[model samples]
Target: MAITSANQLELLQTAEAVAREKMIDPELVIEAMEESLARAAKSRYGTEMDIRVSIDRKTGRATFTRIRTVVADEELENYQAELTVEQAKQYLSDPKIGDEIRDEVPPVEMGRIAAQSAKQVILQKVREAERDRQYEEFKDRAGTIINGVVKREEYGNVIVDIGRGEGILRRNEKIGRESYRNGDRIRCYIKDVRREARGPQIFLSRTAPEFMAELFKMEVPEIYDGIIEIKAVARDPGSRAKIAVVSYDGSIDPVGACVGMRGSRVQAVVNELQGEKIDIIPWNEDVPTFLVNALQPAEVSKVVLDEEAERIEVVVPDEQLSLAIGRRGQNVRLASQLTGLDIDIMTEEEESARRQKEFEERTQLFMDTLDLDEFFAQLLVAEGFTNLEEVAYVEVDELLVIDGVDEDTAAELQARARDHIDEMNRKALERAKELGVEQSLIDFEGLTPQMIEALAEDGVKTLEDFATCADWELAGGWTTVNGERVKDDGVLEKFDVSLGEAQDMVMTARIQLGWVDPAELESDEEAEDEDAVDTEEAGA
Candidate 1:
């Protein structure tokens, strides 16, 4: 326990044993032991004095030293840790200011408290070293499959004993209806390795689609050898999964290779996944074709795509609708995920009926609103004038192409469309007022009557709500509309104001309420000038 000659060698031996056990560099262990011994020595050698200790790596011997800096009397910050010029000359004849001088300090007998303190320091160092080791070992292993034994369960979560460290498999990351017992061997995807205050936390996942893909890679040599590539994977966890694979070699069948002889390869993956059904399909560059493949056994009668909206309408035979949608919409959902497209499945009968209804509605809309005869309204509908907005916003030339519509008539139609929209806005403003929306927000320069209604409907009825709303929320940024992607452009589409004007209006509201500092809006001219000068100088 004491720093006696007999125990000095024992310290180095202990450090080596610890280093071996912890899988750390022996030199690191020796450094930790030296620091611990130095801390203990400080108690006897005057805590204010700079005392340090070193353990010879090869000889297993320890040395204690006291460090002092040679400083002029006027320059000295601490008398206990510094030596004056003349005093330092006693040890070093030519000692210079700011030069360090180290003298051998006699080894002190380690006291019981000092010994305990040393042990604590060594333990803290070892624990830190172990954490670094664990982090290093697993950080790059993220997304790879790891084999471990179930160590314990806490609150329905399983702790796995990975060889070098432990991994936590959260309840949500485990396959549904799957259970693990202590000491049972399991394979899991290393979802993440995070360094937390407690220690390094290696998170494991069994339900991740990557876990299944990795299982396939291990089972199929072609996938691992780069002959076959798994393009995309989607899973509903313990129920169903879809994988799209592509073959680099035209000769090799990727799906066949992944399925293996007699379904052995895919079946092995399914077994690990608690019998999660796997659909191995060929990856196609064409999105619609890929969607059809991802849907598998469902027969697609026709496919209609809306590129701007990024939605696909797939029509199947009446008998195949249930099959295409799968149980609880799982099949279509997985296919959507795999293809990165929103899929709308409908029976051929339903699709035809829906198209007819849309055409009739559009025809009626044009006839009633534009004062057009049934034939002309049908012509407008066929020309893609679905709503009054299209007619109002469309180019003059677009209406001229419609038969029986001259420039004069087109202008009249446009005027009527504007009048209709203005009426709608007037009604919307009235509705907003009835909903108790403040008149101040209704009259706001940047917001249209429609935007006001949208805000009031969402309970943003006051000036404070208007001021506090985020720009995205107020502007109605990008939104997924009926599985179709579209940008609402906030109030920009409804009002003539730009996005900047809308933002300024919000800021004005905040300023009126004194919610924000006005100084932040002021440009820092002096700072800008200095930055310009710096940039000029750097360029020169």
Candidate 2:
């Protein structure tokens, strides 16, 4: 069928209709149509020509042209697309080397295969444009909530038709007890909007903690208006949840505002979550106070924090321990998540017993190691002396504070503590030597006697063996043990040497073995070169 003037007008009208339906620029659709027509035109005019088609937007006039570039003789890379300056003179009076020559070709009739190819091209372009538009619309909307109808279910995942686009709510991201049917109205958090090979993928989630936060934002007017801010949220999804909120204004109570008048606001959120129980706690900057609030309805007797270890030990009354821990440890677990700390909940009795046991063990250790009787050991333990290192390192005045310890006695105790440590080190060094530890390794500056013994036991018995060890093997690097990387299982962990000290020892050994002393290596190379030069001069 010949592409007449009426066909050109029909093509323009069809492009405009499809562009409106797909919500894409009409100009882009026209470009796609022109390219499709150009592809069909290639069958009439040989495919060797650089064929192109352009359609007027307003008049709907279609023009097909073959393009050729005039180039210098040496610049003609493709014979079909380029012509030498001299060869181009036949078609024109004067031709510049970089000028382009376009020849108009008459529009021809299209065969069945050619028309089908044009339709496919148009459809592909429309699909791509639709995907690009969706990506641009939703990419910045990530982390926001949107409502959509459940379009279909695929392999346990719900496909939601969020107006103008579709989103997937995977099975794991759905609430455990909640079920969705087709055409059900659902709201979800836009977890991600990704441009994939097939199209734009919008991933939705209902179980994310952010989803809970967003729901609260919707229900709580103060939260949305920035009067009250949600500090943290942790959810068990359709079971229970904890949210911490703080108010910038002292007059506004954040918890009360979020709970709404007579619990209407929070109830709205719970209804959306399929009756997920939410505990709204007031946020506190103090960690212990925050943790107490996080474990709501469970009275906490005390909270002991270990800041360095990022752990907390909570002491609840014996009657309240079960409540503090909740059913199957859910309360404590959610509290930990809310506060970003590891929580260990125990009864007051259990904590007291544990402290007593630790005290007895420390008292025994001091009595046995320092050769002190029970009275003196108990006095030291009572004064907060836990390890021998502290006893050896403390000033004489510290011991003088203990009863029955005069200046001279304190001095004697210090001497004895020092002497005991020196003796232990001497014995460890002798044993390490007996175990075949090299003299160089033993003499290394940073290697303690205990570290040397550890190395000898691990078959690192010589200076050469020590020098050949990797930094991670000696010091502690992450190593896969039972399919997980362990950081504390380094070879030096059993010894007194720290990871930094282990690394230093390895470098010192390498230097001692002359393996990597750059200054010395350069000097040696220079000396050898000078000697060779002298020898050559003498021979000449």
| Number of the predicted model whose lDDT against the real structure is largest | 2
User: What tens-digit string does per-residue lDDT give for candidate 2 at 1-540?
Assistant: 677877778878888899999999988899888889898988777777788998987878888888999988887887777898888888888999888888998886888998899999989999999999999999999999999999999999999999999999999999998888988999999999999999999999999999999999988888899999999999898899999999999999998898889999999999999999999999999999999999989999999997634678999999998898999888988998999887888888999999999889998987777898888888988999988778888988898889899988887777777787788889888898899887878877777787888888889888889988877677565545894334545568655445567667787788878888968867998999999999999999
**Cα shift from native, residue 372, model 1 (Å):** 4.1
What are the TM-scores, per candidate, against the unseen true structure? Answer: 0.75, 0.86
Evaluate model 1: give its TM-score.
Answer: 0.75
Report model 2's TM-score to 2 decimal places: 0.86
Local distance difference test, per candidate? 0.86, 0.87
The reply for model 2, stretches above 4 Å from the true place, is 74-79, 436-447, 455-540
What candidate 1 gets wrong by more than 4 Å, as runs, is 307-309, 369-372, 383-540
Model 1 pairs whose backbones collide: 475-490
